[model samples]
Target chain A: MNKLAAKYLRPELVPTKACQGCAIGAIENWLLQAIDEMELKQEDVIFGAGIGCVGRQTFATWGGDNFGATHGRALAVATGLKVARPDKKILLVVGDGDAASIGASHLIHAARRNVGVTVICEDNMGYESTGGQFSPTTPAGYVTNSSPYGMAEQSFDPCDVVIAAGATFVAETTAVQWRQTVKVVKLAMQNDGFSFVHIRFPCVQNFGASALGSRDPLVSMEWIYDHTKGKTDDGAETDFAWETGIKHDASNSRPEYSKVLRDLNARVRADMAAGS
Target chain B: MALSEELVAPWAEWQESYQDGQRLLEAGTYALTEGAVAAGLGVFAGYPITPATDIAEYMSKRLPQIDGYYLQAEDELAGMHMCAGASLGGQKAMTATSGPGYTLMHDAYGWAIVNEIPVVVVDAMRVGPVSGITGAPGQGEFYVSRYCSHGGNIETIVLSPNSVQETFWLTIDAFNLAERFRTVVTILTDQVVADMFEDLFLPGDYGALSDIVVPRRHNLTMPFFPADSSEIDLPPNVIGEGTGVCVSPYTHTEEGYDIEEMEAQWSQTFRLINKIRHHKDEILRYEAVGLDDAEVIAVAYGATARTVKTAVLEARRQGVKAGFLRLISLWPFPDELFERDQPYLVCELNYDGQLVREVMRAAPDKNRVHFMGKSGEMHTVAEVCEALEGVAKHQKMPQQPYIWTEVR
Candidate 1:
């Protein structure tokens, strides 16, 4: 708050509606920093805020004017915004319950539409806001408000989903890796057509510790993702090729997309697939 | 000058609007095309549908002369998306359809709203309740227009043009209003307007559509974003590389990231709405024909409005002080117009009272607003005249439900 720190200080109030302590919050801080550092144009960008938490974030507190929409429907909404106002930079934010679940249809289709929009999904491995519940990203053995006796399902890998969905660009990172998350977020913005960035946000309080309050617990994500991230597919470090990728391929027509998804699902059952 | 029935073109010997609908059919299609052209509407991406199919036909045949783009989409969904995309590309764009196609466009409409992307949708209403009357003029989906897009946010600007001329006028206004407010707009007509023909002075260069301010697109570095602005409510959004960041559905902070920012953002969007609503004088547009000093006021919009106008004229000839208020702006519902000094008749062609409901919400005096409406079929001047006569004589009106939207 002091003038002395003001010169070096960066703005902290993010323009989105992410929940408190939600990994999505830092996106503003980092993105602002990137913009300031990169010196990009403010008029050139447009935003497409998808449904669920992202909807509230857009149509409200974002750069230029932003569009927001219903749950699991943000991608399609973004696709529309991008199409309607192609001159503006388009960026979409979504969540596991939103992107991996209800919005899957729109997510794949938007990428297929490919008019270019930045898409970032917050994967806490569970639906935390709708009450710590099971999500498409929930680990097979994880428990939630909905999944009582431990989830009998494995989480989806969104990166492979992007590549197969015909996304021009795709990457996966974690909120804890603030720098990397910021990098990908910025990069996704720069990518033409549909760009996907999956944030492996650890729901430390909800899914991991169930500590309604707070704790320092983190995902042993390093165990699942090879040090090489999701790209080194020589099995060099990532023995499970299916685990470390965007889960669905929307780019492939109808049949090929179905087959690739089916194969990806098989690996997920064995924990051999990537968690992001 | 008061428009005379004799002036109603096509010289149809038949006296009723329902019977002499030949003019209505051609008028609806021509007006839609002319409206688009007026708004600097340079693009029309659409898929053909019955009753609404002529919108595409007219555009395809006429847009080239105006240097407009008329491309048929793979389907209704894609057609709507193309409309949205073209708008973003800095072109006023539109599309037309009925129930089935309208359903497909729901997704596109939602996107247009959240992004404050203004678009005009011409939904020539057909039957519904699961595609009830596709080609027949059924006002079934009147209420559905509110829900056509996403985001529970309401107060969208939808107009109903009863006559062909009004259709042309409202179509141009759709683009103007959309660009002005940065929201989706609708010209909700029915088979009556869609399938009608009328002689209207098509405003040259989009019918005198000029001097309207369209928002300049702001990218990341527009300086408007993060506008070193000291104003409260919301910071200016800069749209460059990093500042453009990511905007998602998750509640995010003011910097364009999906963070825990719901409460903060909710206030901001409401502020946006407040900013627009406060300027009621600029947005409040409507017409009061034959109501200089009337005992009864028939308030309606779209094609229904045309009937109310006709009916009011018929009543006046019979010495009844009947008048009509053709509501131009449906959302930001013209409360001032209804609350003003006159008895009212709310008429529409829908099952439930949607437009009339808004009138009631505005002027809650209750007794003054005579809700005369119908839905199953379009209203004729003769029918409106009868409704006006019953309401004018202050007779205990029969409880017979209107076949169109016959409810209290």
Candidate 2:
């Protein structure tokens, strides 16, 4: 195993259950690299995972304290963990279905509360773990098991949703752009309040064949890069690119949920002491 | 100070916040909410549901006063998930909801059961097949509390409170039981009990709350919900406590790793079920009134039990031999408490008899069992007396059939 992988992952649970050439593996690698770059202790981080292909990576690889939350409840779980232990860093890892579909309310409210937690949503277009069902993020006219004829609804842009919901920092990246993914994750971790990173990638085993018209994982990666907008390391804008940069970065003036709670508690204690 | 004193000093400070003296007449829901605070509730997450909304509203105002956390989740599903998360974080966590919202919480409740995370879910039931009546009372969720969430053979610790005072004490008991069993403990109250106003006595002297045993970091490396029966009593380790324990909703092995083999599944499922079932004697609790020499016994629970008690007294005044058995612990179904030879009239607020079904199964004579139930309305004292009179006269009224109607 590589040094970065060995440092961030549990040794016995290495070589994840993710499918061959699946972006989830690459995304996990980038996340570990980001943690390594930040020099954060694995034990100090609490990882919350929702139910999906991306959620499976939490226990399968991440060496932190793992909370396998119910479908679409990873952020809510992370919120609780963050509040309970404000000194620790909480990271929520969920799939597109978890963040934008059933658990969409959690994502919006977590951002609205400005809780101190980082959310990383692995957007593979559809629910890949459940046999290629159409997710809320599956684009219009995309065909999958559930949307055989093609999805009628327009796809959701989670980055824009989180930004509107009052996230302190929001960004978009892809699995193929490992360095950019790491950079975005590092930025999110450094942010004071709710941070959201929407990582769009293809499900090589499921959605790749049906929706993206590609069976090869490399072809899927190429399709993701070619179809979306991206920015080079030097920060030059390009059309139809992967759009790999921070979309929103709010000032740290807004109080976090835990800090506000602590302040209120301190005030209450003071009132009690004054005996008024 | 010693090491143990250092560990307990924070709890001591929290206990000092407990107020003494009567807080005045309030709704049963207030008792529950205040009782949760008195029980050292560290976190409360809930969504707005009629009859149960006051519990959340009260917590929102009170929890922050003591540095406790209160979050109004987007919905009941998220609320329940938050409660599970908070509980797993070494806090006594709870959530409140009515029937419709309770239905949305089945998935998370099941997750808590499988992961063995302790949480208290307060269900103030209204009439329901789905949003049947928001204003009316019903004991319709009795079965749902026990058998909720899809899949096979799951048992839970369910406590039903029949009075405003019982609501307070039972809320504390609910948390205690949840902590003890390392499972979900549900406090099932109805709209009548939850919304009814009464003078609740706050104890003059408050004692230190019962300590919830959080597993030490050294012991957390083992399976959270150990498959071995002897080691099943250990509480789950809190996350971010330097206990890198992995908790999953799937059937998992001793090390908290997901496993799909039949033996592993059987061991895990068996442990989850038997952990509560084998301890039924400790879990099952009920109050029997005048069952000793009575010819007829009326079995009831929650708000309906209060009316049943009144009717029993009225029946005795009329020279009828009717007694009441008020069920406090609805699940683990107190089968041994039932007298097989005596005829029973199971009364509830729901049209379809949910609790009576359990009565029939537990009683030796199923033929002698009778059900008097109505939906979207509480049972009148006169109606219960009439049922007792009819049962005493040996004239069995036909079982009330469930009537389903759409309400806009």
Compared with the true structure, what per-residue lDDT tens digits does model 1 show for residues B1-408? 463222211112112222312233346878788767766776677789878888899887666555555656656666666566556545677888887788887777765554455578888887565577676675555557767755564346676666776676567666766766666788777877788767665433333234432433434443221212223222223223344433333334444344455675665456445545656565566667665567777777766776668778788888888876776656656677766655567777666666766776677566666666575576777777776777778642434445333336
Highest-scoring model, DockQ: 2
Q: Per-residue lDDT for B51-157 in model 2, tens only?
A: 89999889987887788988888889989888888877777889999999999999898888888888899999988778877898878888899887789757888
Candidate 1, B-chain TM: 0.79
Write down the lDDT of every candidate, Cα atoms only.
0.59, 0.79
State the TM-score for model 1: 0.67
In angstroms and one decimal each, the interface RMSD of every candidate reads 13.6, 1.5
lDDT (10s digit) by residue, model 2, range A67-166: 7777888887777767777888888888998899988988999999899998999998898888898888887788898888998887768888988989
> Evaluated against the true chain A, what TM-score does chain A of model 2 have?
0.93
Instruction: Quote the lDDT for B202 in model 2.
Output: 63
lDDT of 1 at B103: 81
